[model samples]
Target: MSFAEQARPIERRTLYDELVERVRGLVVEGALQPGEKIPERELCERFGVSRTPLREALKVLASDGLVQLTPNRGATVARLTVEDLEDVFPVMGALEALAGELACHNITDEQIAEIQDVHRKMVACYEARMLPEYFQLNQRIHELILEAAGNRTLSAQYSSLAQRIRRARFMANASDARWKQAVSEHEEIISALESRNGEALASILKLHLNNKFHSVRKWLISQENGTRKG
Candidate 1:
């Protein structure tokens, strides 16, 4: 057989994988609220998939802690408790601090410019009160920093924990005060990165993550209190 003939087209993602991402987005974006039942029928109709693939996707989400599978009750979005943040954020802070330090050593001027551009856009989103867009850009900046760090192991570990708490992180911006404070922190982050001050960047990153934990914790406590009142 000719080498050309032996070559294959790039494989597309499987339907099951696509369903998993779509369903996970629902959970992350709050379309499927925490503790709310996963409406299998509605989703099946919307995605035009059978129960088999959807259930498989739900299983993936459950493993990610984004959903809970019950015996007879089916799946529901998992709630983010203060305890979850308390456990996760400190580790995330340490990881982010390390990433910031390494990024200061390794990142190129062009990479810093790329992050600055995104940071400007994120600031604009904040000014406009576009929480979702701001969050996406905010996430992109951190991802770029991780990429700049050039550590696959750190990236993999951080990403795993990141996926588990994305919804809670998004909710951290629910307060205008916290959001402004976060933006101020981002400014300091960029300045430190631009200066290539590894220690300063590390300190700022740890403090940033710590503040985010406080914001998310406050929001979760408020939510629990509201639930109790209702």
Candidate 2:
């Protein structure tokens, strides 16, 4: 093969993935919404894609619990129930604890600074009351820690669990007090990582996640009850 041919940029994203993202974005933005039927035809028209790829994406989303598929009723965005949080939280706590432990030993000073930089920006967002931006930075800080943990298997598993709970995380019911408390906890996370205290980081991360689960659970319960009423 020619060098030019070999050097050409590969199309890494599949049509199915692009379609899945389009649908996922709609769900996260509250457009598709929990329990609302996925408008497959409208989506196809919007994306200018055929039903084959769109249906394939729907199946993928169903497996991820972002959407549900019914025999005759078709697809709707999945609701994250309190029960769902109950099942997922313990698993997430374990993964987060594991990541925290690993990261303290493996994280470099430069990497630590990078995470701190994002944390600083996150605090700014919180101060500015820019929730959407704060959520983005919050996810980035967590991702950096997972990366620093240096375990592909742990990162992959943690990432999967993270994806499953992202809707709740993004919609977390953070009262002003809760937001302040979260930022304070993040300060300890940084301190532990900087001091290379693996056990301390693990406990902090696990406990922090435990607190986070309750906040999200409150929101999920309300959402579920609201949906029922509507």
Candidate 3:
């Protein structure tokens, strides 16, 4: 066999993996709300894929806590409750704090500059009240920190848990005051990173995550109460 023929190009992504990401985005971006039935037929038509791959994608989502599967009832979007936040936030907070500390030590000046650029854009999004764009940039900032931490295991673990709460975390900015406070917190985070102050960054990250948990917790409670009243 010729060398060129033997060294065939690798497929970057599988159909199943692509389907999983597309479906995950639908759930994360709130196109598929929590507890809503997974409309298999509609999605299959929309994506021009068959049930087999779609269902397989959903199974991956279920494992990630973004979808729930049942024997008779099929699948539904997994609802993130206050209880769920209570369970996950502390762990996430610790992970984020650790990431902040490690990133301060490990991140290069160029990487820090990159994050600052993204942060500036995020602030502009906040000023414009562009929630969707702000949320995307906000997530990117945290992801960059995780990448700088240089721990594959930590990144994998944090990412898995983050997927479960991405939508709820995005909605935590519903309160204008809380949104302002979060931006202020991000300012502090940038300052600490710029200074390479690991301790300060860790504390700020923990505080930031704690505040977000409270914001989300309050929103979830109000939503549940409103449902009951309705």
The number of the candidate with the highest lDDT is: 3
Q: What shift in Å separates residue 89 of candidate 2 from its native position after superposition? A: 1.1
Global lDDT for candidate 3?
0.91
Clash count for each candidate, listed in order shown: 0, 0, 0
Q: In candidate 2, what are the lDDT values of residues 43-90, reduced to their tens digit? A: 899999898999999998898778899988889988777888898999
Ranking by lDDT: 3, 1, 2
Candidates arranged by TM-score, highest first: 3, 2, 1
Candidate 3 lDDT by residue in tens digits, 1-230: 89998899965986788999999999988999898999999999999988999999999999989999999889999988888989999999999999999999999999999999999999999999999999999999999999999999999889988989887777666678889999999999999999999999999999999998888888888888877632
TM-score of each: 0.85, 0.89, 0.89
Clashing pairs in model 1, backbone N/Cα/C closer than 3 A: none
**Model 3 stretches astray by more than 4 angstroms:** 1-9
Candidates 1 and 3 compared by lDDT, better number? 3
Model 1: what TM-score? 0.85
In model 3, the worst 10-residue window by lDDT is: 221-230
